[model samples]
Target: MKRIIVAITGASGAVYGIRALELLRKMDDVETHAIVTSSGQRTIAHETDYTPGEVRSLADHHHNPRDIGAAVSSGSFVTTGMLVAPCSVKTLSGIANSYNDELVVRAADVCLKERRRVVLMLRETPLHAGHIELMARATNNGAIIMPPVPAFYTLPRSLDDVVDQTVARALELLDVVMPGIQRWDGTSVVPDDG
Candidate 1:
C-alpha cells in the first residue's frame, strides 16, 4: 500500500482538510497517515462539525503533531508524499525556514529532502510580500505551495463541489488520480473550421 501523509495545521479552512482526508480514505490503494497540529484541532471545532478524534478515524494511522518519534519524521522513512491541507501562514513560514519543531514541518522537510512531493494548501488571503516570499522559498525547496483558490470555470453548484475541485487539483500535484471538476475549454465541443 502507498503511504500518504496528511497534515492538518491550524488554518481557518478546516473543511478543506477534512474533505481531503475523507476523499483519500475512500481510495483503496492509498493508506492515509494523518498528523493534526494543535491549531488544527481548534480549527476543527471552530470550523467543522467533526472533532479531532472523528477526523482521525478517517486515516489508517494517526500521529500527533508533536510526536517527533513518528515514522514519518525521518527522510529515510519512505512515503509516496505528504500534503498539508489548509496550511496556515505560521506553518508555511516554519516550512519555508525549514524549522522542524514538529511533525508537520518535519515530515514536509523529510519529503522535500527525499525528493518526494509535498503539497502545501496554504490558506492565507491578502498575501503581502512576506507571504509571497515564503511561498517562493517553499517552492524553491521542492515543496508545492498550492493556495486553496477556487475555479469559476467549473461552475460549482455547492460549497462541496468548490472545495472538491480545489482538493482534486491539489491531489493532481501529488500525482494522485481523482475525478477532478470538469473544466470548460475555450473552443466549442466540436472543432470549428474557418
Candidate 2:
C-alpha cells in the first residue's frame, strides 16, 4: 500500500484538507494518515459543518499534532509524500526553517529530508516579502508551495467544484491522480483575429 500523509493547519480553507482525505479514501491502494493541528480543528468547526472527529474519520489513521514521536515523524516511515492542505504561515515557517516542534512540521521535515514530495497548500493572500521569502526557502528545501487558487477555465458551477479542482491539483502534485478532474486541453481558447 502507498502511504500518504495529509496535514491540515490553522489556515481558513479546512475543506481543502478534508476533501483531500475524502478523495484519497476512495483509492484502493492508498492509505492516508492525517494530522489536524489544534487550530485546524478550530478552523474546521468555524468554517465547515463537519466536526473534527468527522474529518478524522476520513483518513485510515489520524495522529495527534503534538505527537512528535509518531511513526511519520521519522524519515524511515517511507511515505510516498505529504500534503499540507491549507498550510498556514506558521506551519510554513516551521517547515521552511526545519523547526520540528510538532508532528505536522516534523512529518513535513521528514518528507523533505527523505527527498519525498511535500506539497503545501498555502492559504494566504496579499503576500508580503516575508511570505514570498518563506515560500522560497521551503522551495529550496524541496517543498512545493501550492496556494489554493481556483481555476476559472474549468467553468466551475459551484463552490464544491472549485474546491475539488484545487484539491485534485494538490494531490496531483504528489502523483496521486484524482479521476474526473477537469483539465485544460487548449480547445476552449479562441485564437485572436486582431
Candidate 3:
C-alpha cells in the first residue's frame, strides 16, 4: 500500500486538505494518514461544514499534531511522501528551517531527509521577501512549493471545480493521480489574432 501523509495546517484554505483526504479515501491501493494542527481544526470549522472529527474520519489513519513519536516521524516508517495542503507560512518556515517542533513539520522533515517527494500547497498571498525566501529554501531541500493557484484554462465553472483542479494538480506532484481530473490538453487556448 502507498502510504501518503496529508497535513492540514492553519492556512486559510482548509478545504484543500479536506478535499485531498476525501479523494484519497476512494483509492483502494492508497492508505492516507492525516495530521491536523490545532489552528487547522479551527480553520476547517470556520471555512467548511466538516467538524474536526469528520475531517479525521476521512483518512485511513489520523495522527495528532503533537504526536511527534508517531510512525510518520521517522524515515524508517516509509511512505510515498507527504502533501501539506494549504500549508501555512509558519509550517513552510518550519519545514524550510528544519524546525521539527511539531509532528507535521517533523514528518515533513523526515520525508525530505529520505529523498521523498513533499508537496506544500502554500495559501498565502501578497508575499514579501521573507515568504519567498522560505519557499526557495524548502524547494532547495527537495520540497515542491506549490501555491494553490487555480488554472483558468480549465474553465472552472464553480468554486468547487477550482478547488478540485488545484488539489488534483498538487496531488499529482506527490505521484497520486485523481481519476477523471480535468487536465490541460492545450485545446482551450485560442490562436493570437493580433
Candidate 4:
C-alpha cells in the first residue's frame, strides 16, 4: 500500500477536503494518514455535514494536530506523498517557510525536505501577492499548489462532479491514477461543424 499523509486545515472550502477523503478511502492501494487541525474541525462543522470524527474514521491512520512526535512529522519516515486539501493560507505559509509549529505543518515540512510529492489544495478564492509568493515558494520546494478551480468545459451535472474532478487532479499529482475525471488530451478529433 502506498502511504499518503493528508492534512485538512481551516480553509473555507471544507467540502473539498471531505470529498477528497471520501474518494481516497475508496481506492484500495492507498493507506491514508490524516491530520485535522483544530481550526479545520471548526471549518468542517461550519461548511459540511460531516463531523471530524467521521472523517477520522475514513483514514487508515489519524494523528492529532498537536502530536509533534508522529512518524509523519519526521523527514526520514517514508511516505508515498502528502496532500493538504483545503489548505489554509496560514498552513501554506508554514509549509513554504519550513516552520514545523504544528503536526500538520511538520508533516508538510517533512514532505518538502524529503522531496516527496506534496499537493496543496488551496481553497481561498481571492488572490493576493503574499498568497502568490507562498505558492511559488511551496512549488520551488517541490509542492504542487492545486486550487479547486472548476472547469466549465466539463459541464458538471452535480456538485460531486466538481469535487471528483479536483480530487482526480490532486491524485494525479501524486502519480495515482484516477478515472473520475475525463481528461483533456488536447483534441481527440476534429470538431463537427454541422
Candidate 5:
C-alpha cells in the first residue's frame, strides 16, 4: 500500500483538503494518513459543513498535530510524500525554515530531508516580498509550492467543480493519478498576436 500523508493547516481553503481526502478514499491501494492542526480544526468548523471528526474519519489513520513521535514523524516511516493542502503562510514558513515544532512541520521537514516529494497548496494571496522569498526558500528545499488557483478554461459551472479541479492537480503533483480529473489537452490552441 502507498502511504500518503495529508496535512491541513489553518488556511482559508479547508475545502481543498477535505476534497483531497474524499478523492483519496476512492482509491483502494492508497493509504491516507491525516494530521489536522488545531488551527485547521477551527477553520474546518468555521469554513466547512463537516465537523473535525468527520474530516478525520476520511483518512485511514489519524494523528494528532502535537504527536511528534507518530509513525510519520520520521523519514524511516517511508511515505510516498506529504501534501499540505491550503498551506498557510505560517506553516509555509515553518517548512521553509526546517522548523519541526509541530507534527505537520516535522513530517514535512522529514520528507524534505529524505528527498521525498512535498506538495504545498498555499492558499494565500496579495503576495508581498516576504511571501515570495519564503516560497522561493521552500522551492529551493524541494517543495512544490502550488497555489490553488482556479483554471477558468475547465469551464467549471459550480464551486464544487473548481474545488475538484484544484484538488486533482494537487494529487497529480504527488504523482497520484486520480480518475475523472478535467485536464487541459491543448487541442484548441489560440494564436497570440504580438
Candidate 6:
C-alpha cells in the first residue's frame, strides 16, 4: 500500500483537511497517516460537524502533534509525500525554514530532504509580503504551496462540491486520482452559436 501523510493545522478551512482524509479513505491502495495539531483539533470543533475523534478515525494511522519522535518524523519511514491541508501560517513557516518544532513540521521536513513531494494547502487570505515570501521559500524547497482556491467554472452545487474539487486537486499532486471532480474540459468556454 502506498502511504501518504495528511496534516491539519489551525487554519479556518478545517473542512478541507477533513474532506481530504475522507476522500483518501476511498482509495484501497492508499494508506493515510494523519497529524492533527492541537489548534487543528480546536478548529475542527469550531468549523465542522465532525468531532476531533471522528477526524482521527478517518486515517489509517494518526499521530499527535507533540509526538516529535513518531515514525513519520523520520525519513526512513517511506511515504508518497506529505500534504498539509488547510496548512496554518505557523506550520508553513516551520516547513519553509526547516524547523521541526512538532511532528507535523518534522514529517514535512523529512519528506522535503528525501526529495518527496510536499503539498501545502495553505488556508489564508489578505496576503502580505511576508506570506508571499514564505510561500516562495517553501516552493524553493520543493514544496507545492497550493491555496484552497475554488474553481468557479464548475458551477458547484454546494459547499461539499467546492471542497471536493479542491481536495481532488491536492491529492492529484500526490498521484491519487479521485472520482467525481468536475474538471475543466474547455468545451464550456465557447458558446456554439450555430
Clashes of each: 0, 0, 0, 0, 0, 0
TM-scores, in order shown? 0.93, 0.96, 0.95, 0.92, 0.95, 0.95
lDDT on C-alpha atoms for all candidate structures: 0.87, 0.93, 0.93, 0.85, 0.91, 0.91
Clashes of 4: 0
Per-residue lDDT of candidate 5, residues 22-136 (tens digit): 9999988899999999999999999999999999999999999999999999988999998998899999999999999999999999999999999999988899999999999
| Candidate 3 RMSD to the correct structure | 4.3
Total backbone clashes of model 5? 0
Clashing pairs in 1: none
Query: Candidate 2, after superposition: displacement of residue 36 in Å?
Result: 0.2
Off by over 4 Å in 3: 189-194
Q: Estimate the lDDT of model 3.
A: 0.93
For model 2, how does the per-residue alpha-carbon lDDT over 72-191 read when each residue is reduced to its tens digit? 999888999999998999999999999999999999999999999999999899999999999999999999988888898888889998998899889988888888877766777232
Ten contiguous residues minimizing lDDT sum, candidate 1: 185-194
**Residues 30-71, model 3: lDDT tens digits:** 999999999999999999999999999999999999999999
Candidate 5: lDDT over CA atoms?
0.91
Flag regions of model 5 displaced more than 4 Å.
Answer: 188-194
**Best-matching candidate per lDDT:** 2
lDDT of 3 at 87: 97
**TM-score (C-alpha) between model 6 and the true structure:** 0.95
Model 6 root-mean-square deviation: 3.8
lDDT of 2 at 128: 100
